[model samples]
Target: MSNLVLFTELRQRLDDHLDLVSRVAAEGDAESALSMIRREVPGLVAAVHALVDEHLPDDNGSCRKCRSGPFWRRIPAPCRMLIQVHLAVGAAKATTRDRTRWSPSRHRLQESSVD
Candidate 1:
């Protein structure tokens, strides 16, 4: 399949997974929601990797293509948002040693510290 088509399908799947997560949360099934999110992460990362490898250019030292206009703009918004969110989450995870540091109480502490 073409990269665009694959990206569109992956975005749809990610949307569906997000809906499932919402439903699970509403049903008070935190464990199941977390499990579903964990399962989806690898697929999301793989999709992002595939798209990057396909469309992005490998320069000698600089990323000139990424800074250029309209290439990334051709991608759908949902796919872009998913990629951004995945990167943000990955960065957040990397900054902390314990994943459990993302708990509600810790979040509140972090928020307060920012202010």
Candidate 2:
């Protein structure tokens, strides 16, 4: 399959998995949620690390993967990808600190934390 197709399929599959986990967390046992976390979290962390590594600045302090403009203008260090990560993490932290309800915002919290 083309990369676009593969990426779409993978994103859909992950979305479906998240949906399943949400259902499990809401209706199933805690043990099942904990088990799923144990099984999938390490791989998820590794994937995030791989993306971070790919986007990291080169020796000249330009993003390795992201560029724009006719001359391919360099995006400086801490490119959009890393900045989004920072924003997501900040949102997640703020959300967690302010959260009192779990039933309504489960997926939002998870998405922010893992974005």
Candidate 3:
């Protein structure tokens, strides 16, 4: 699959997981919610690895085409910025946390700190 498509799917899956956690938390079943989140952790980590494997070129971590092709000799600045933001967010979320208190605002703050 194309890198963009794969990334989108992975992101969507993450969102779905977060949404489920939110719903379960609202129900006040913190223990069960935490259990489910722990169960999903491995899959989320794998998905992140998959994204890196697909997006980063094997040799130098640059896009193969953009590195060699005449695609303006650059990727658009906005896109590069977005990728940086996404990666920063990912890094922030790497620290394991108690899912019982995993609020979306907290998730976003974690992501933003990478900036």
**The best candidate in terms of TM-score:** 2
Between prediction 1 and prediction 2, which has the larger lDDT?
2
Output the worst ten-in-a-row residue range by lDDT, candidate 2.
100-109
Q: C-alpha displacement of 77 in model 3, angstroms?
A: 12
lDDT of 2 by residue, 1-115 (tens): 8999999999999989877865675567889978877887688779789989999887878888895564357899889888777655555346434542233323233323332
RMSD of 3: 8.4
* Candidate 1 residue lDDT tens string, 51-88: 66544433432233344455554443333434554555
Candidate 1 lDDT at 65 equals 33
The alpha-carbon deviation from the true structure for residue 34 of candidate 2, after best TM-score superposition, in angstroms, is: 1.2
> Which of the two, 2 or 3, has more lDDT?
2
- Per-model TM-score on C-alpha atoms: 0.34, 0.65, 0.43
In angstroms, give how far residue 94 of model 2 lies from its true place. Answer: 5.0
